[model samples]
Target: MKILLVEDEIEMKDSILQYLEMEKYLVEYASDFNLAMQKIHLYEYDCILIDIMIPHGTGLDLIQEIKKIRPKTGIIIISAKNSLDDKIDGLNLGADDYLPKPFYLPELNARIKALMRRNNYEGTSSIVFNEIEIIPEERKVLIHNTLVNLTTKEYDLLEYFLVNKDRVIQKNALVEHLWGDNADQFDNFDFIYNHVKNLRKKLLELQCNDYIKSIYGIGYSFKTIL
Candidate 1:
């Protein structure tokens, strides 16, 4: 899932980013309020982690903006301040959950997963499309009851396709989801072609239907298997 972390503390931001990346989450960060707003306006995220004590503006304001732009996006407030009013106000403003500072990374991850399951995954732990099944919590993929071994990127690609089944996904969107803000560092999307080709080969080898389709001059679409 794509995550936007709005935090100012250097150490705390680094810690959270590292941990989430290791957990195979596509994470991006904004150190201050302006950068956070820029990112919020530019992209959509599955979940957003907002630190209440940010520079330039309050995290609550950012949450409000996010709600206005993407109403269904999951939101979590991570603040050092344990003020009751703050938590209440944030929750009242469409925030899904609140986490106080100095918490474990695993707990934060758990909350993200819980929020995603509730909001994005339709409250289900697994996503199934015909014979293909994905357990996001376990980061496992199964085809016809057989486990499919995949690299982290491959798994993420498949998950993206399954999540947006029957929709055409632009190459730029795929790059941004996988690489976050750093997607511009690459010259071309050739790497994406490689990943898609390999993923297709593996699934076809398993006798799975071809759900990933290229749109000629455009991007690709993930169709439902008949």
Candidate 2:
């Protein structure tokens, strides 16, 4: 999943980035409130981790703004401040969870997973669509009870398609969702075409139905009969 981390401490930011990346999440970070605002406005994220004590603006303000712009996005407050009022204020401002500093990385990871489950997957550990089953935590995809090996990018692409099934997803949206800030480095969406083609080929090889359909001039859709 894609994550946006808004933090100021260099050591803490680096540590969280490294840990989340190791866990196979696409994470982009901002050191202060302004940069965080820019990121939130420009790209979409599955979840956002914000620190209360940020430069120029507070995390509470960020939460309020996020609720206005991206209300469906999952949010968690991570700060050194552990006051009851701080926690209350954050929750009142629509923060879903709070993690006080000096917290364990595993705990943080668990919180993110739980939040994503609640927000996107209806709190389920596995996503099931027809013959395809995906266990997000394990990054495993099974087709008709048979394991389907997929590259990291291929797996990510499949998950994205599943999440937005039955909806037309633009190629630019795919690039932004997968590549984040680095998406600007690509001049065209040929890379997206290549990835989707590979993923489609893999699923077809497993005798799975072709759910992905190209939309001519627009993009593609993961069409489901139901």
Candidate 3:
């Protein structure tokens, strides 16, 4: 899943980014409110972790703007302010959940998973697309009751496709979802092609039909319904 962390504290932000990345989430960050605003307006995230205290504006205000832009995106208020009123106000403003400061990364990850399950995956721990079964919590994939070994990137790529099944996902968007906001650091999308090829080969070896479709110069689509 894609996550945007809006935090001003350098150490906390870095720690969250590192932990989430290791957990196979595409994470991006904005240290200040202005940067946060720019990012929220530009891209959509599966979940957003916002710190109420930041430069320029209160993270509380950003929640409303984010809701207006992407109502389906999950919101979590992660702030040092643990006052009852603050929590109440945040939830009242349509935030999905709240995490206080000095929290463990694993707990935060758990929260994100819960939120994604609630909002995107219909509160399920597993995603089943035809004969393919994916248990996100366990990071396991099985086809025809047989496990299919996939590299980390390959698994993430497949998850992305399943989440956005049947939609034409642009190459750059796919890169961004996998590599986070810094995908521009790469000059080309050849890495994506290679990963897709490997994933297809692995699935085909398991007697799975080809579900990924190339969209000419645009990108590819996961034709799950076919």
Candidate 4:
């Protein structure tokens, strides 16, 4: 999943970034409030971790803006301030969870996973669609009771497609979702097409139906028959 981390402390930010990356999450960070605002406006994230004491403005204000712009996105407050008032204000401002500083990384990860499950999977532990089953926590995909080996990007692509099944997804949206800020480095979406092709091939090899359909000039759709 994609995450935005808004933190000012260099050590804390680096540690969180490293840990989250190790856990296979696409993460982008902003060390100040203004940069955070810029990223929030320009890109989308599955979840955002914000520090209450930030430069130029407060994370509480950021939460309000995020709720107004992307109400469905998950928000978590991570701050050194452990005051009850701060927590209450953040929660009232639509923050989904709060993590006080000096917290364990594993616990933070667990909170993130729980928040994601609640927001995207309706609090379910696994995602099931027909013969395909995905356990997000274990990063495992099983097809017809057999494990399907997939590269990291391939797995992410499949999950994205499954999550938004039956809707047309633009190539640009795929790039942005997968690559985030680095998406600008690519001049074309040929790489995306290749990834999709490979994913289809893998699924077809397992005797799965071709749920993905190209939309001519637009993009692709993952369709399921009613």
Clashing pairs in 1: none
* Model 2 Cα lDDT, one tens digit per residue, 33-107: 899999898888999999999999999999999999999899999999999999999999999999999999999
lDDT tens string, model 1, 138-216? 9999999899999888998999898888888988889888888888898988678899999999998888899999977
TM-score of 3: 0.93
The 10-residue segment of model 4 with minimum total lDDT is: 217-226
Q: lDDT for model 2, on a 0 to 1 scale?
A: 0.93
The lDDT of each candidate is 0.91, 0.93, 0.89, 0.93
**lDDT score for residue 101 of model 2:** 98
Tell me the tens digit of each residue's lDDT in model 4 across 70-102: 998899999999999999999999999999998
Error of 4 at 44 (Å): 0.9
TM-scores of all models? 0.94, 0.98, 0.93, 0.97
Winning candidate number (TM-score): 2
RMSD of each: 1.4, 1.0, 1.6, 1.0
Each candidate's clash count: 0, 0, 0, 0
